[model samples]
Target: MKKFLSLILALTMLLSLVAVSANAEDITLDVIIAQYGPNTQEWFLGKGMDGSNFVEKFEAANPGIKLNLEVVSWNDLYTVVSTRISNNNAPDILNIDVFADYANEGLLMPVQDYCPEELYQDFFPSFIDQSVIDGTVWAVPDLASARALFYNVDLLQEAGVEKVPETWAELEDASQAILDAFGGEVYPWGIDMTTDEGQAAFAYYTWGNNGGFVDENGEWVLNSDANVEAIEYAIGLVNKGFTNPNPATQTRYDLQDMFAAGKLAMIIAPNQLPTYVTDKEGNVNLATAGLPHNEGATSSSVGVMDRIMAFKDDAAPDQAARNEAIGKFLTFFYDPENYVGWVSMEGFLPAVNSAVGALVEADPSFQAWLDVLGGAKFYPTTKAEWNDVKQGVIDVEQQALTGGNVKELLDALQAKIAGK
Candidate 1:
């Protein structure tokens, strides 16, 4: 009777082991993506991926891996991510603009842990560098958009402006000409100093004046001489009635809408402005020019990029298998055929070199834009103090707009951030 009972227990243990093995073969990844536009959700979960969604196709190709992808809007992304992290429920994969905080906190897995070497090599070197912190790559750039000066060709001609502005003096001259021609019926230039986009305003003007958030060595310089001059000049535009009224309240969308309706003559915008105008059914004849700079300052195209990062998940039963699954997901996502379509659908620039040829082939203008992006200067988002500087500059700009001294405000901000 004792032998019979032992045999029965052994058989039951064998059955349990078999069940565990079967379950180990399947894994699920929770991915959170920031919505780029109206098409972002459709492309990922709907029928935007050549009649098949990304989740469906990826699962079909990799049978063992399943995806739970969620699209979060920009407004709530930071809050959502923060809440999840506080609850220790961080997503397996995250797509967002900032990563230094996560990486610095040791919550992210290094890129090499899951990214295939071949796929890693395909990313643009400059773009890849942007995600590095202290010799470690924390994330991979997903996509980028370069900013430039967009003007209404007919409006400039009608204003008797002979050529596109390449310097601040020229820009001011053109603004005056447009104002005189239209008698203030149209805003000569658009500035977005609203809280939602004041960082961009800071970049557009400060970088143009040979001042930026950091030095060549990536140290903070928020109160540099050039920066003070830049802020003063921007405020001067408002005081002189050369820019859109209520810049403190007007946002990029408001400016874009004004541009679409011919209420704005010139604005610094992303590459998607023309598509934006077309979508709005506007018939304005637009032309692009390099962002104007101070006479001796170098002109730089401002590039905005978001990244894909994997969070640390130490609780997996088989770490190697999980890493391999993540790698497959990235490979499938970055495959030139799929990447080209995704980039084109959103009208943004590709982050990988492999998609460049196909994109340029589809649109000749893509080549020119790609060339511009190659030399573009990006924000210092990799810094641990990036958020402080971003909000600090915006405050400085807003304060300057309302009778606050630019130098004093910037000095205080610099002191505050430096102390941090």
Candidate 2:
């Protein structure tokens, strides 16, 4: 009897140990994020007490689940994410841009595997549509940004411009008057036409003129008459002394600083500028309006959105568990209350429809962004053609603005697209 009792006790102890091992395995997860530059990690986390508060809350709500965040410079992010994916060493969660090459490589897991269809149905269809590749939804939309006219209302009033321009002709006229009023002291308008941001700003002009990057068949259609006309209009602004002479040299932040200093009468930038334009003591008074279009044309801007992606790798132990953790974290992070904090604090538009309504109720200043969101359209996301398209637009626009022949530039662009 004593021997039998001892045997039973040992077997029970073995079972308890096995259970402990399984629970330990379930308590940890690895989440990686791409860091763009200096202090970018802080930006990702959020600002001040709000940021610290959220991090603590997230960890507490997810007890025993360890989150390991890695930060890499933008220059190194693509290489890092790619290498990890190639080796099947990808982290459980990662942040990626919508048009990145990884999406083209099919390295990401579809969000549909975890999220309910109805959860995403109410999101802006165009925004959600951009995430679909080969009929699989690879990521969840996080934040969105839209281009709008960032004008100094006080400066416009000083120049005797009674109202913001609603048409291209009026924009040109207002720009001329502002330039004349400010002389060499202030730039009438400043655009960063040399960078991707510049190209995006240029998209508005092309779209306003009834042009686009591709046709119904998805072939590049950049050299069309409407596109050339749009390019010409942008060049005209430069020639009329309405733009800063060396716009190609200015960074997006530099342009924003100039606007804040009242050195720029009008400019086109993302809806987030108000947060960056505070006064000497950190007060803010900047205002935003929609980008003007040609009369009888629809106005547009280059739209950018972010994605949270998961990677597939059979070697990663507990793949199912990690995916479950990610789904939970996203649900926590995207709660309407939490989302408002993230968007308002980070200067981004919310990804969920419910979050958008919550934000509008909380902050009236966001109304302009909400208004723009109602009409926003994304840039092309067909495939690897994005790099070629981006470079082509920049090259042609630079040539057209710098006294190069528009026709010759357009012809070359068409040839490049056809060759692609």
Stretches of candidate 1 above 4 Å error?
Answer: 1-24
> Any idea how many clashes model 1 has?
0
List model 2 lDDT by residue over 1-420, tens digit each.
Answer: 999999999999999999888767653545666553334466445454354655556677887566666656656777887687677687667776744466677666678665555566746677777877677777777788887887887788888888788788989888877877888888877777766456675587888877877766767788888888888888888888888887666767777778777788787887776766763232324566667787888777667787777766566577666667777777776777676766776677877887877787888766777667768767776456776778778877777777888767987888877786
* Position 78, candidate 2: lDDT: 72
Candidate 2 off by > 4 Å = 1-24, 27-29, 34-56, 71-76, 79-88, 116-122, 216-218, 279-286
Q: Which ten residues in a row have the lowest lDDT in candidate 1?
A: 19-28
C-alpha positional error of residue 123 in candidate 1 after TM-score superposition, expressed in Å? 0.2
